[model samples]
Target: MSTYVVTGCAGFIGSNLVDRLLAVGHNVIGIDDFSTGQRRFLESSLKSERFRLVELDLLDIDALQRAIKGGEFVLHLAANADVRFGTLHPRRDLEQNTIATYNVLEAMRANGINQIGFSSTGSVYGEAKVIPTPEDAPFPIQTSLYGASKCAGEGLISAYCEGFGFRACVFRFVSILGERYTHGHVFDFYRSLRANPNELPVLGNGKQRKSYLYVQDCIDAILLAMEKAPEKFNVYNLGVDSYCEVNDSIGWICEALKVSPRLAYSGGDRGWIGDNPFIFLDTARIRALGWTPKLTIKEGVLKTVEFLQANEWVFGARD
Candidate 1:
């Protein structure tokens, strides 16, 4: 069994990936800072002989290097996910997301590990002119400091691939939906609607439609890409084929909770500063690898709501 090192292993996507890897009998080493990721996510896996958990900040160069050693592949998922937080603390955002990525890449290089799968975002497109944005889409303007930092991280990885002769696959993700999402539009809606059951705070105008990928599908594609990854720098767009409006998602959340909530606008050009209004990913590249996402927006949302309902204790008691 190949040993795989996963950063941000306690986060939504990384934890899910670890579970999937363990199911297939892979030796998995997970490292997390527990800053935003919950330690509870790794609790169930602690008993497994195949699983190793290292609780350390990626910013700690020595600890990161030690954790990454002996891994065949590194899945880098640690990042400042809250885009809005960038406006308040831009340096923290850069340090955690961008600089942390640089640390990961350097650690990979030091260990002679050549394979890497990077997690980027469609936010890199920054006010895209093209519908269903492609992987090669031009990222001229980064509306958010968060997006710009990610773009910088991607550039660093791309250059490393060329400079160090390592193979890399960059997956530019859209809004990832599924269970275990601690924060996102859906999670927020669920929390708000559950609390009030009458009024929901909707960000932006509620007309911003976006492509989303279920976490399971995202994990599957990452593995598939690992199985069939090509030499040179390979970038793929990972997202659902259909786009759903923000208001539509709100409606779905209310329907799931059996509540009719009044929608209240938070106000803005986008949801917040640096939010993309409407953008879709042209996933033909990843789809060519014979990986198709099974969950539609509605289906994914429902499944997420079910998980949230069943695990009401996750966000603390429903009251």
Candidate 2:
């Protein structure tokens, strides 16, 4: 079995990926600093004999090199995921997302690891003129620091592939939702409803269009890309074929929770600085590899609501 090193192993998607990797009998080295990730998410993986958890930040170059040594593949997912508040802390995205990614690449190079997978975001498209932005869609002016940082990270990976002959797979994900989801609009809306079931403050006009993929489907796409995509540097958009409006998702959540809270619009087309009003991704490339999401947007939203309802403690935990 191959040994895989997964950064951000305690975060939502990272933990899920770690569990899947270990389940298939692969040795896994998981790295996390607990800055935005939670230990509880890794509870199952932590019990596996083939799993090793390294508690350190990616910026710690020495420690990072040590963690990645002898690993055949690296799945880099750690990042400052606070898109809404990124403007509040201007340098947070740069240091956490961009710089950390560069550090990981350097560590991989130092340890002679040639394969790296990155978890990028669809926000990199910014306000794309295309309805369902394809992988080759022209990049518009980035609206958020988080998006800009991710874009920079993608560039670094590409350069590493061309310069060092490393193989790389970059998956641009739409907003993901499923079990262990602790952040994003779904979590925010759920927390607001829990705090006061009578009224809910909806961000923006709730007319913004977007796409989402269930976490399992996202993992499936990542694994498929790694195993099936034949390219020195590959890029794929991991998302469903359809899109949904923010209001529609809110409606689904409310239906799942059986709460009809008074909707309070925050008075804007977008939620905050760097918020894209439309974010539908064209998943043709990944689909060409025979990978498709299993859950629909409505089903994913309902499942997220159900998971949060059962695990209310995640709201108060790291997010």
Candidate 3:
């Protein structure tokens, strides 16, 4: 079992990865500043002797290098995970999401780490012209600063992988929904209904459709990609192929909550400045590697809603 350094280890996806790695008895060193991730989320893993948590910001190069020093591979997932927040505070988004990634790469290089797996997003393909956006989708004009930052990070990874001969995998993830997911559309809908028990805030006329991947599937693909990583850079699109619209997801949440909520819209058909109306990822390349998502959009959303309902305190504290 190789020692791994996982950035954003306290976040939803990172925490899940930690659980899996620990289950398999792999030694893991995790680093997170808890800006978006939570310390409480990793309490279970912290109890394990194989796990170590470094409470340091990724922007601190020395700290990151120290955390990653003896690790054989790095899983880079630290980021400003909110697109709306990116619109409101562009500088913070770029600095944290983009610049932090650059720093992580530099730290890995300094530590002589040549293997990395980056958690990228489908947002980089902003409003794709084709359905099931491929890995080589021209990386269309990204709208939000968040998307641009992710694209920039991907570019940096590619350059590093090629120039330094490191093994790297870039996963363009869709909307991830599952246990511990506290910030996606599913979580947002559940919170809104719980607060009012009657009114649900609907963004964009609710016509938006996109694939949603369960957290387990996200973890599975990451591990599989690492197992199948190439000597050079490799990028893959990951998501459940089927698309579910925003309004439809709201309906699912209401049914699960057993609440009849009035729908409220922000109007204008466009949800937000950087929102993509519809997107589907082509997982053929990753699927060709024999990795398949086990959860559909509905299954993922329903389970996520249940988790959100059961753990109201997690979302409640931030509210």
Query: Which whole-number lDDT from 0 to 100 does residue 298 have in model 3?
Result: 91
Misplaced by over 4 Å in model 2 are: none
lDDT of 2 by residue, 87-111 (tens): 8997999999999999999999999
lDDT of 1 by residue, 148-197 (tens): 88888889998998999878888899988887877788878888777799
Q: TM-score for every candidate vs. truth?
A: 0.96, 0.98, 0.97
Relative to the true structure, candidate 2 has a C-alpha RMSD (angstroms) of 0.9
Please tell me which model should have the higher TM-score, number 2 or number 3.
2
**Looking at candidate 2, what is the lDDT of residue 16?**
93
Q: Candidate 1's C-alpha lDDT?
A: 0.86
Q: Estimate every model's Cα lDDT from 0 to 1.
A: 0.86, 0.92, 0.87
Query: What's the lDDT for candidate 3?
Result: 0.87
Error of 2 at 147 (Å): 0.6
Best candidate (score: TM-score)? 2
